[model samples]
Target: MPIEPQALRVLMHLVAHRGRLVGKEELLDAVWGNHFVSESAVSSQIKAIRRATGDTGQTQQVVRTVHGEGYRFVAPVQEEPDAGQPPRESSSADEDGLVSPADQDRPVVAVLPFVDLSPAARHAHVARGLTQDVIAALSKHRWLRVLTGAATARLAGHPDVVEHLREKLGVRYAVEGTIRLDGERLRVSASLTDTAAGVCLWGDHFDRTFQDLFDVLDELADMLVATVEPEVGYAERNRSSRLPRTDLGTWDLFHLGSYRFFQFTREGNGEAQRLLNRCREREPDFADAHAWWAYAVVLGMVYWDTEPTTDLLDDAIQATERALRSDDQNAVFHVLHGRVQLARREYQAALATNERAVDLNPTFATAYCGMGDSLCYEGRYSEAIAQFEHAVALGSHDPQLWAFRTYGALAFLFAHRFEEAVDWTTRAASIPNCQYWTTAHRVVALAQSGHVAQARTEVPDLLEQCPGFSVDYADHKLFYLKRTDQRELYLAGLRSAGVPE
Candidate 1:
């Protein structure tokens, strides 16, 4: 009786573990890669294996069933050498036992297979799917390089695998986690580790009801991906601070620049530009660096009133274009490109570019924010508000949360929904490190909504923060709005708020 290939593989696996019981789900994942299948499939394969090995369900010999649990190969087994084949050769390893090269310039991360801690070990497929989802999400960013699933699986059960991953796989960071299911509740816990230093950079725990398995997986993956990048950035910034400025690499400079950029202040923006310039000089081919550089220029022009000379605008355009040239698939590059288009008053082009960015990375909150801004400029206020709300839901704790709120407020204001505009802009202003522009929207919304006293009270602070702001500046800012009435409505609100002409 000849056994099927899957059955043969399952038999070999059982023989390797001989005395230990293996769960049916584990066998399914190992042989079928987690494709949905019935338990009957495993039963059929086990029956075939028993027949080929001359074992019976009644005999309790060779393969033995452990009641409701799984199976164990109880009979002794031995490896046989093929007469026609030579001995297998082992792969080369360095002195540290690492197989990959150690001179990687970018941060390399490995997402290890998630451990299943559920009762009866029944959720192995869910754990594996979560691991794969995280890998896929992280791979979309051009900055980080992710290890292959096979490489990560090889190191899964090894003792002291964190150090082994650093040495063998050349990974600077490792993401390890476990999933557990108790009744209908599911819990996921994850930690980001700096392999070189043997320190945990970050950790998080999430709990949700297992109402819809795929939905739960998607929400978990999105939250993890969103948290990981910022945590890595924070870790890298701390690491870079201890190193001499003269010795900083491109990656270090980028992280340091990002730390300053998130401060949302004029001085921070200036320092960010200087550090990113150094990064660009060191590695012109780094697409993420170029995209961020363009973003810095745009922020300076929009918030700081930095004079945007033709050369400066051209440089911003060139930076984003080079980033796209380097990696057209990167959604971040497209977001920056769309921002540049918005600055140029190319509303249609901006809208289309941002849509493509969202299509590339559905979980990218900034892309949706960009899309909202584009729609707002085109006088599509309702549609724009929806996009902004979606962005907020996706990344409520994002570093750019204030920006999303401010934009959402602006969309509502343009739609003549003054109360909502006031609510959102007030929320934006209340957030820590919010830029001064948030107050401008609040003043306009309050004044237009007949709260003249409150609006007037806010004027002194707004003027103190933005002395150069006036009706003319507002007009220039609203130039992107093609509809004359839409632009005039914004100007009238500013004038109502006591803005100087």
Candidate 2:
């Protein structure tokens, strides 16, 4: 009669991407880690989830199949009602299957790469450069998870794949634009697309004298960020997409690092580390690499312990500083730096960093997410919840899905909503992605909520795999639940559940 962990994980992901038909392939990729599983495994799990939810394939009623595409969640979710607390305000879902309108009441957006109409390889470089610049400007939002440069570039050239990109990445809106250069003259155009509606939300074009290249790019960044800023429900005056430093060749280092950064596995993360390290090595003056390298250490740290975490993170701070020095104008670097600052428990500074990042990169989802987290640390629980829920609306394929779930659960736990805390943490523990030491928190939440039997079962594996996992990453200054009082209680509960830790 109980729900299985695997099925529960699928259901959680479904809820995360609920209200829209998610492609089966996307589900496999996001939930099952794609490359390692069989379609039958997914099919089998779907059936199990249906059984848990009290649905049959004939009625396939709750999780409906969309013929050739994928499955969708039809039922509205109830948070199991946190004990002693009333349901919070709810917003209407967004027309874009990506962001529910309720989510918009928070704020987030994705900036796609710009297209290059010129065939010269140099023109391609220009398009990607323009995109990287825009990305930096928009990354200031701490609560946002805007697609990284590489992901946007991958989708940039293929406007035809926009739908596929939307479905797979799970973002509400995308900023698609183009750049064309005619001898001594420049033209740039940008359009905001509601991924689900296939309609342009806003469109604008900029023309500038070729001699004023930097000015032109800056103006374009300003215009684009401003245009998308209000749409995400943030004020235009708060926009601050400036990279902290400007001397570095952001295009080369950023893209190279981005291509390597997505490897996602322990080894992939290592390769990313190597590439970003190289970027730092070559561009010692480049601050962006530091920001990225800090992010890389965070990513590498997420899967397994590779570096002397303290040393790796310290280095991340160094990299972020260099990026800030190069061009302090981009919200990307600011949000990223805020993450590192947050890890250091520079709470006030981190919040300022995230706020600044959002101001620069109004459409940046990670900024919104970071804003929520910073607010949580500041005991702004409701605001933090709004930011987390908003970032979830923007969606992400980050190697850190479990972290997101864990962080969301932590917010609930600390806010003293035990039931909601238990639900989110339990969902996090069941993530099919790489495991982290953070699983201990889920056990802690379960035990605290008196779900001792469940606690007894998960802690042993949590210990064996991430026995020493502590939730401190210099990249995201979240001083996680470190006290062992609850961890010990969790161990006792797991023991009662017949788990040996």
Candidate 3:
């Protein structure tokens, strides 16, 4: 702790020169600058530097004396230029690793995957559900990006997640706790810990009747969100946006639709679409029902070029309007409407829709993706990257993997990370019933990324097969030819990428 200033400089000098053998005379010259210091002083300072840096040993030297020459700093270094890379190894092994990963552009948090503390009590389901719900709950917060469950699972344990969270999640704090059940009551206790100082910022417990599972889970989720919101420091929307509603069935239906829509197949699409439709019928003014229905339309048409109904688009517009009418603050519904508009070639309308959606729910995944799509149509690439990255943070369900890949490709293409674009688009091609939009992006990505041969060979059939043969081709242009520059860039990219004649 009392290493002199001279010793501190010496240790840093060694680490700064992680490799390359430096003579002890060089160290003295660098730190002492020709001062009349004795060789003994230099040797003593070297020892102090080594000890301070925990480089314990005569042979195991961080600063090795080259027998008659001098000392050299010895350490293997690995640093990736692309900074968003996830931690490759645990930082518990590195004494100097302390930076948390909150890239100013992307909010970050860690999900402490629920631990099955009582394998005997059979609470795995409850625990897993709680963690999942908490992630979902935290997700609704506009200011924080919760680390995906898989990323945070490596950080699990009683207080085990503390430091791991700071170093891994790059979050200032983490939400962690345990679950228990006693006869008729369900108990949950959670605390948010500040990783930097290792202190508990907040904690709460909820106890509810066995049948009150829904309410208890929601309350805990709410508490977790509200507690973290203040700490995250996000600018809030107007009071109307923050107002709570009494409606529950609509949200229930929405979650159900979300749960079922993930199969990425025809039937999964049909079931989810039907439930959302019924949801609107049961609650005529529920905007989300209509919005989701529009999304369903995209999937349904995955098998044909003709639309389900001539008024299918009109239905989406109506539902979005209804959602806004009942609660203009509902960003999700507006985003749904935007998705329809984007598909329909109404780029400006789509952009406005997503802007409002983002204003209402900054964390909304589809809203940002919609905004990205709108910008892509308009050829505004940089802004699109920022928005799409947000969509990735918010996370979409399985049905959205294709959508994700599409956005990822766009993000890379527009941002000029062309190689990455090709890689993501290639992955997207395998998605079940991948839409033309996905394939089209892949075409462009591959071409621009220097895989022009493959791009040219695959795009024509893809573009011709737009909408999986389900779109109302008469109403759908299947390509954006709004700007000559945009059209040229696209066509050139596609040609280079392998779009057929």
lDDT of each: 0.79, 0.61, 0.61
Candidate 3, after superposition: displacement of residue 371 in Å?
1.9
Candidate ranking (TM-score, best to worst): 1, 2, 3
lDDT of model 3 at residue 16?
Answer: 49
- lDDT comparing candidate 3 with the true structure: 0.61
Task: Please give, for residues 61-152, the per-residue lDDT of candidate 3 as tens digits.
Answer: 46777777666777665644547863232211124422111112133566676655543678777887878877876666433456566656
> How well is each residue in 65-118 modelled by candidate 2, as lDDT tens digits?
777777888886775535895422112211222322212212235677687765
lDDT-better candidate, 1 vs 3: 1
TM-scores of the candidates are: 0.74, 0.46, 0.45
Which candidate should be chosen as best, given lDDT against the real structure?
A: 1
**Mind giving the per-residue lDDT tens digits that candidate 1 earns over 1-501?**
888877876776676456467777555544454255776887898899889988989996888888777789898766565699642221112233222111124577889999999999999999999999999887776566777677678677899898777654557788999999887899999999999899998888999997788898899998888778666656666676677787665667787888788888888898988888877765555566677888898888888856666688789888898878756787888999999888878888989999998888877888999999999988899899999998888766578989999989989988989999999988888788887678888888888899878887898888888778888886765544677877777778778878788
Residue pairs with clashing backbones, model 1: 98-167, 98-168
Q: Taking the candidates one at a time, how many backbone clashes does each contain?
A: 2, 58, 16
Model 1 misplaced stretches (Cα beyond 4 Å): 1-103, 196-200, 477-480
Model 2 backbone overlap count: 58
